[model samples]
Target: MWTTGAEQVEQAVAECVELLGAVTGRDWEGVRAGRLEWSCRRTAVHIAEDLIAYAGQLAGREQESYAPFELVLEEGAGNADALRVIGTTGALLAAAVRTTPREVRAFHPYPFRSANREGFAAMGVAEVLLHTHDVAEGLGLAYEPAPGLCDFVLTRIFPHVRPGESPWRTLLWATGRGELPGRPPVAGWRWSNNLVLGTERLTLQGVTPAAAADLAAVGDGGFAWIEGGPVEGTRVGAGLVHQQYEDGVHLPEWGMYVLVRREDGRAIGAMGFHGVPDAQGRVEVGYDLVEGARGRGHATEALVALSRWALDRPQVRTVVANVERGNTPSQNVLARAGFARVAEDPGHLAYELREPGEG
Candidate 1:
């Protein structure tokens, strides 16, 4: 339920309202929220505003920009009224999250320009948890949300933050709301949503760590695959992805992707980076298809899409691929995808595709 969205948003909102509603008669306007310039009253209204905005984006299927509307409270409204608005908007967000399909992506401009249901829910939960802390601190009301909610947000969106001794404290530290023992002060931060790109017949679905762990265990990674699907290499790649995730070094975009046929929704293959772009901006890539689906140009299509996506990144100057010396079919796939045989050895062959301007 937490992973899906609606239940988690409801859970977070329940905690937020219960905590703040208890102190409704306090001087919310006079007391500044902890570590923020806004008064506690303003912070409460911001929560409602963000919740409704997210709901609008999903419910309206907003693309390219936010749904052009703002939440304005009536003049002379008090703290109880603001808390009521939070509950109402929170319900709207929950309904939106429940109704939005997993495949549907809406506009969000952070590291990427789009976000799916899970991303919006995680963002919503983060806002409620973090800002409520600020409000609680200022009003001298005790508050600590469920650690599981914090864990959910961190894993789904805050993939770059390493897990610390305490999940809640770690989340606070990651967001610049608190301190850690040794890590540098977080001067800036942004949440990342997984990227999806489409080809003629395939959607290169970015693999989340949750999916990776299941795939590594020979599961479908929540994707429906063609018969004789997800061969050993794919599982091995998934294991590698899960390892990176467990180590907290996995960037979702740089991780694995499952190639799913759009028409029938059957997964055809897997393709992705071996790791993030190296210091020189060189990134290694690998791909494999199910036996029954091979030789249909699926590998070539996915390779081209993944390579194009990688090269388009300003940090990536080249994409590297390694094939066993005897693998003629694999070499043909790479060649068809426009990768050149840049180097070779006794047992292995190397290919590299460089950005157009790379010397």
Candidate 2:
């Protein structure tokens, strides 16, 4: 069955191909002109070649085919052939999806099975959509995505959906879009992709208060946004690492927390908050995880637990939060956890929530 959601991949691909037709072959000059230090030849050929390679990979075909084609491009594959090859190949991949059951198995980049045409179609669509933008941008034509494609692509890829992180923000994390908050580089600990905790494939082992101090120390010279205050990397002497403190003068009430998550516990990544409570008797909450830990609702689950704990206190009545305005991903997180938007600031906007109380 073809749900509108299911056809997202196709829509992205078709738009890419159509946009390619609007530009002339010579438009590649613009591509070359604006090329990154890494890439060249922005045209149908460039887009097409990558599409074919992606299609073949998803189809469970040998990577050798894609490899040689990529090499040919690097060796200066002619624009004409590149265009023809990519266009034909991309079309064929789409056609296969139209005529086949998405669940048919095939070799994917990851070890898992394509197991269906849908998976292949999804991969193919991603390839075409991405390359199409590359070529379009190279040719100096404006590139706007189909209304919902970016959202569609992001939700498919990112695993962690947290309160401060939006689908766009998550997309940035997944695609390596933005710079990460810098931390002092730990000498003995192994570094994962973006998160700074000890890496044992999803566990937070060996993160002592001292190690947290070291991490904040690493950030001192490198991480500009995060100032190293008294608590920047203070070791609380227990298993806990108080990486950051929630304060106005020491550190702004916004944009920081006490990093939490047991190195070996089921939870992958989380943070704890400790600023003053708001009128509603609640405090702010925020956290994010490594890309691998998303989609399991760990964020919501963790926040709920934290809220319950906060509400248990007699002094607190409401929690206050300030998500980056327009960040839907984090907004969704706050919404899912029952926090509602109450006010706005010039830079960071605010949210409010009354703790669970007995009437």
Candidate 3:
């Protein structure tokens, strides 16, 4: 995967500054920004606001809410000044992303309540790209960001969106800002940061389509893994995820999660659903651990946590798993995680964990 971080943030801001700098002397306050109600000047200021806010979120480690502060320019600040502020704030955000530890996550109110450093960086890039387009359109100037920048935003935060002929157009369409061929115009939209669930000793980080593609291609999927990790099973599972994403049927929260140890931050395994729940409210799950990490209760702990999370959902009544008849260790993990055998075929045994108090 093309890693998104401080570097991407800096690149995006540089592009924004260079583009807007050329028109700084124009009457930005009087003209509306493309389809937006804000003027080009206000849109530029908004970009700076987002950049600094993301920086504060990481630097302050503010959890539960945004940091109790806002960005305000001195009265009479001009377009050139706003561009300078954008550059400064973008650098601040980049510094935060660079210094933040991989495990750190702070508050962000989106489809989820939190985002890590990469998430914030991706969001910052997105703000610069989209709003820059708006301002450019209003100014009657042509603009197109680098395809990789657009792809970076799409793969990391817009994982559910199907790749279109152009990553830029696909991003615009996904955000309800533009049209695309053969697809309904987006009515409303929100970008998703991958979900992360915590257990006593593990954090089950949801795998984005970007990570899925990398893992399927034998990359580390951006994770630091224990030896023998990302085993064949994990890669196979990742391939299925990428396939679902390509098919445009992937629901992120119901997808794969890498089980990273909370104590040391090393990924030891993967666990997740086959897909969304069926008509009977049943969802199938599977998991695997690196050879060096097995027999330490990691799989059982993750299975128990994941199964409970699934069962608690209103649409889920049972969490199911299948184990080959000869894989007694796998069967034992399921048993310890509260799954009861429900059926058996010649090759495998099926187990189910029902919601609490369900007969």
* Candidate that scores best on lDDT: 3
Highest TM-score against the true fold, candidate: 3
Whole-model Cα lDDT of every candidate shown, in order: 0.88, 0.45, 0.93
Report RMSD (Å) for each prediction in the order shown.
Answer: 2.4, 18.3, 1.1
lDDT tens digits, residue span 239-350, model 2: 1223231111111222223233343323244345544465656576656544555575656655665666567677777766677887767677778888878888876778
Clashes of 1: 0
Model 1 lDDT per residue over 32-148, tens place: 999899999999999999999999999999999999999999999999999999999999999998988766789999867888887898889999999999999899888899988
Cand. 2 Cα-lDDT: 0.45
lDDT for 111 in candidate 1 is 67
Better of 1 and 3 by lDDT: 3
Model 2, backbone clash pairs (residues 3+ apart or across chains), number: 29
Superior by TM-score: candidate 1 or candidate 3 = 3
Q: What value does the lDDT take at residue 340 in candidate 2?
A: 77
List the pairs of residues colliding in candidate 3: none
Give the per-residue Cα lDDT of candidate 1 at 75.
97
Ranking by TM-score: 3, 1, 2
In TM-score terms, candidate 1 sits at 0.90
Worst 10 residues of 2 by lDDT: 245-254
